[model samples]
Target: MDIEKIAKAIEMDAGERLPDIRESLQEMVDGKAASVHTPEQLMLRTTRQKLGLSQSDFARLIRTPVTTLCDWEQGRFNPPGSLMCLVEIADKRPDVLRDVLM
Candidate 1:
């Protein structure tokens, strides 16, 4: 086996592969190939943003840990059905949720 030729071939292969990988990443960043989030994940993030609450505040309002809330929002874990129902209610009626929590 010729080591110098093998190394050159490997470098050329990597150079060729990088452009496609970079293009795919750029597409994602440009929202042309955005990753799909589950409905629960979308709800978790949107509800908090609509409520104008930070992750910690939203987690407190929902009686959950901040890390768990982050996990749900990031799609590392799904929120429970019960939590989803509450999130829907919150999304539709932010004032009511706040008033009840108060």
Candidate 2:
């Protein structure tokens, strides 16, 4: 079935494909790796504090609830979909709060 010819072709192409695949894979890895954050916790804490509201008030502002916010901050519960999006945007660009919050 011309296996030798096929193998030779593969061998020649593998060098090019491998590096391209590897570079794309590394870029994906780097993109994912960069997402890890601590600022969500900090901002959730600090901004709420500065506003002189308990977790309850922040939760109300976010339209969740005190218990949910507590659970999220304390790591007992994961932030749900919309909240998680807000958290990511907020953490990354806190200066955009007015825009993001809207």
Q: How many residue pairs clash in each candidate?
A: 0, 0
Q: Write the per-residue lDDT of candidate 1 for residues 1-102, one digit (tens) a residue.
A: 454455556658877534345555556557695667997898789989998999999999989999999999999888899999889999999889989994
Whole-model Cα lDDT of every candidate shown, in order = 0.82, 0.62
lDDT at 22, model 2 = 45
Per-residue lDDT of 1-102 in model 2, one digit per residue for the tens? 454455456658775433344444556656654334355555566666665667876687688878878877766656666776665555566557546454
Highest lDDT against the true fold, candidate: 1
Judge candidate 2 at residue 46 and give its lDDT. 62
